[model samples]
Target: MREHEAQARTPRRDARSAATGQARRGDVSGLHYTPDKARRSANLAAFVQKTRAVDSRGAADLQKLFAEGDFIERIGALVAPHGLRIDNVADAYTMWWITAWHAARGENDDPSPATLTAVRAQAAHAITATGEIARASDAQKQELAEALWVQSALIDVAMEQAKRDPSRLRAVGDAVRQGAKGMGLNLDTIDLTSKGFVPVGVGQNDAPATTPKPGSAAPYGALALAAGGIGVGGFLMLRQRRG
Candidate 1:
């Protein structure tokens, strides 16, 4: 009976090994076998590599889009309903792009409420600039809408990434600045002032220095000297009158 049990276990072990071998050979029958830990790790690494490749492609595309002269025009019709002008849209887009880039790098990319409000206001102005949002053909409108959606999605993803890692904000800013320069735009001149968002290292030169009010208290030593001088002058006058 023990010999028979050993023989039976040998067949089962052989079958299991065969299945694993088939799986290793990329057989469809091996689908039922769960991959080993090493296999799983390889799959994960491949997935990450693919994802990074896609992201790199997207970043290149975005850079190309930024450098195009007709970028604003292409997006203008889509944003018209929100009353945004070309400049307004450009400003908002730049803001979102910079923030999104920072966020993508795992930086604190949260925009201030003022910045949000300003962007919204510009979008509104864009709507007014177009005079009518429905003027574009349906297909054109759809394309514009899709483009805007992509932009918004990028921003959302960046924001989420930034939430996970906040150390990449400076890098993000540098990236945006470089991108803007490549497009013949100055990052510093983007005009966030209308939204109450001043760039770093600005406004210091124009700010007035504090001045003391007239007739304020003098130093203690000066006060003491003045009092002593008055007292001596009075004593001299009194002594002269007596003489």
Candidate 2:
């Protein structure tokens, strides 16, 4: 992604309350990634690099998808901020989900077209199951989390297997579905189309801010201050001379 592209959306905060609140929600309903964002998420990039077939076609396709696909773009947005950091469990979960999502959806070695459809179906089911699990017992939540991670892992394995042989799409799909059962959450209602910053703090609102870029100088203020200082200094110098 171009630096200007990243610079375009000045790093404004949605009040600490909002950004952090989203962080705390532990839900993935409101996460969206635009085409531009996917290009910058290092974690996603790394995953692509490690698993994608090393060729111009694969490279170009991945790049293009990252820049244009809604799903890929959302993954990019999430990956960019944390860059593989598991600091927040929500972020970690989001990253893993997207990684799995992308791996399954891609035409790469992982999921054959038929299997890919099945994988999508499984994801839909997993998503639904996740919502149910949310209201279930603690044991259920733990079980759900594990199931989600496993399903996600199967996506990775499938992708790897595809890259290695390219004929195991069915196997990959089956593996992905089976693994998903181990993850405790579902993917259906966890909306991935809408994304915004969430903030949190005492009495703090989660409204996004409109501010100048960090490195951008407040030229007007600086000039005004300088002018005032210069005027004061000149007056002091003149008075001293007169004395």
Candidate 3:
């Protein structure tokens, strides 16, 4: 059977589709299923029936996720055999939904209390799912770790306070420094506040590095070239006259 059909019968995930009014459990077919899978399928149907429902974009991403088998299959091929349980997969889906909701709201630094609570819950679930996947192969583990980092960043943005405290700013700076380090770029020696801002390894009085304006060049070089050309032409004319 096809992957989507398999997913519709998979258990926890198909619940979102039904909940979003896309399809009913009875409508899903073309999957060879065991009785246990069938029972979970029905549960998914029911849970989806009463949930808040996902938006259209969320619905589409969920479909893509199902088509890709939640990335676990891809990760499995690169690494040794390991599996993602249904719950962790659902957590990933929930994380996506939360991220979509935040984005739709313009990703404000602070949301309403109720929204904040919901977002925090989603972030926590994502972190938990990442932890569960950490035991998988190195490739799989890295993917999970990146997902956790994304959620953590979202949480930080969502929870920023307006006090504009130095400590919070310092924390953000530290994170930026560390991220640069991860990319093998050391930025510690770059001073942003030095007087005159002479760049390291460059002469203090060196002309500011500006691109040559569209039609400009060093005058002396152009003059020298013109002089040389004239001298050559004059020399040739004299030689011709003499000849």
Candidate 4:
């Protein structure tokens, strides 16, 4: 995709919570590539999702929708800090669900238009069925964590599929100092459209609604969807890339 839609409101956390989060930053091992390494301690905050109600059972059902794909490890690296507790089956299930949400591949290394639609549909369903799937302080954190997953996962897809490679992942990573630029915003403040950050999106001009673009939504539906959700003014642009 030429641009990944991304946008976020400023943080709503209190200074004390912010400070505590800062103190805990160094303990996060999820920043690496291991899924089981990001745990710190058992946190009890409930996920108050806005879309719908959910529970461990509902989350397990959602997991069945996930697709198997490559570079899921890359996606885990992005959201590891927020933490996932295997003791909490729903949280762990969601971690896997979100990971597969981004890493699944399709025919010729790209998904068909129908596949893209299905991806977007399932993401929407996830929002509905995952009110309590994650173990986070609140919905904002959930959004931040998931948004980061989208970022990392898209980079995985874009590495080989983006036709223009304008925001070359390698160069862009260097520009952000390996995501430090965005992370400096305290997760909530990381502006995807910030200086030097190119938002990724799906589709191309003159393309059919369901026509697949190389690395656009056809290949990176989760990425495209996340960009639109977090993107400026909450608009998902729907822009596409060339073949």
Candidate 5:
């Protein structure tokens, strides 16, 4: 996994409520956000809602689907053309569900052959119909982008938490789903291809200003340090023997 540097900017102000001008503070059940963040929050909320809807049996099936050796590579190839990358195993799993949701909602919009092939590979796990990708309204596109961004944010937070304690990954997943349920979005009506249903207080605050690249130096630095230490130690031992 690549090391993602944390953002250096000051946190933006909390989002204002449309009905009330006051800054929406974090509620006991959830976090507050500005309009943009709200959209992301809503996207994540909806994602969690759908995830929660999956039955245990279906989840096991999904686990099996993701376990395929080529699954991650296939997803990478399909999304890379669109300037996206799966950051981790959790991101890959979240993306699988998001991809299925988009396909079901007809949001693919003239998917390339590679995209189609990737989609078909997981067709059996789709909870909804494997609909064709068709052109969507601008609002729909914006919604989809925001949703993807939110998914990335959730994955980032979950990955960070997992670093400290692996069990927190499951807890984070469950919490996100629960948070979305608390936000009151009618998950059944969340159609990414349609417009005009903005869920309040759900914002995209968690996303970093810039997406980090997987080629960052942190991973390589550790290897380099270890190799250099080994070389230095061997040289010191040889010098002492010669003395």
Candidate 6:
């Protein structure tokens, strides 16, 4: 999966609805904010934009950044001119997703564990390098945790869907919803690029979640890579957990 392709598959909020949509989630966008809050929000957006630009350019060096243990200083420095500061958990949370997708979309990788490792590494750095995670609201904290759980779940379901139809990623949101269904999570809409998510229910089936143990790093949106080493056998192995 190329970076642009991975991005193309990830759902982003419709730009026309960003303000109203993000505002409802109590995110950086609201009717008004303190001057400092507005500044920070702008900086965060700049950081996200700058980093994503690197991926868009088709540069391979992104894997180097993804391999680093701490993003607080590493990524922060890269996007500093663009105004990124590691002062808030929202920034930290957003960076994790960015790096995860970058890493997952890189070459010769398995998507599920790659996403998990990227997220875990970012959380580890956020915990050690800043007080923001500790200071984050309980709701924010839970959102971060659930997002992590959904990381592996997303890949597993996509892989399963790919078995029946390799182009399942073309409809990424729908595929992700099927993954959420197994966990009994009802989603109105789930967008990976968006900062917030709300699962509407546990599940219609009332089935217990059978999360896969994070095994090894991989790529996202690379159903084609399944043929590299994870072919039919690997997909079958995933059934127990993703079912």
Output the number of the lDDT-best candidate.
Answer: 1
Candidate order, TM-score descending: 1, 2, 6, 5, 4, 3
Candidate 1 residue-wise lDDT, 46-149, digit = tens? 32233235454443334443333333343444334444333332333434444433433444334555655565444333333443322333333333333333
Worst 10 residues of 6 by lDDT: 208-217
Write model 3 residue lDDT over 1-243, tens digit each, in one string: 699888767676657766755432222210111223344333323222212142333233323322333232222232122221222322332333333233222332323345434433443333333443323333333333333222322223322321256554444444434433443323353221112212346644221121111111111111122112223233234323422
* Residues 66-181 of candidate 4: C-alpha lDDT, one tens digit per residue: 22221223334333434433232223323323323223211112334444334333332333244322223333233344334334333333333433454554343342232332
Please report how far candidate 4 places residue 241 from its true position, in Å: 21
- For residue 107, model 5's alpha carbon misses the true position, in angstroms, by 27
lDDT scores for all predictions?
0.37, 0.34, 0.31, 0.29, 0.31, 0.35
Better of 4 and 5 by lDDT: 5
What would you estimate as the lDDT of candidate 4? 0.29
| TM-scores of all predicted structures | 0.31, 0.28, 0.19, 0.23, 0.26, 0.26
Runs in model 4 lying further than 4 Å from the true structure: 1-136, 162-169, 175-179, 185-243
- Can you give the lDDT of residue 224 in candidate 2? 20
RMSD (CA, Å), candidate 5 to true, equals 23.1
- Give a tens-digit lDDT track for model 6, residues 1-243: 699876765545455377666544543321111224344333333333333443332112222322233322333443344333344333333333433332233211232434434343343443434444444544444333323322433344344455455344434435334434433333343222221211234323221222211211122223222322333334345543432
Once superposed on the true structure, which residue ranges of model 6 sit more than 4 Å away at CA? Answer: 1-119, 127-130, 173-243
Model 1 shows how many backbone clashes?
13
Q: Weakest 10 consecutive residues, lDDT, candidate 1? A: 208-217
Better of 1 and 5 by TM-score: 1
Residue-wise C-alpha lDDT for candidate 2, range 72-115, written one tens digit per residue: 32323433433422222233344345544444343332223343
Question: How would you order the candidates by lDDT, starting with the best?
Answer: 1, 6, 2, 5, 3, 4
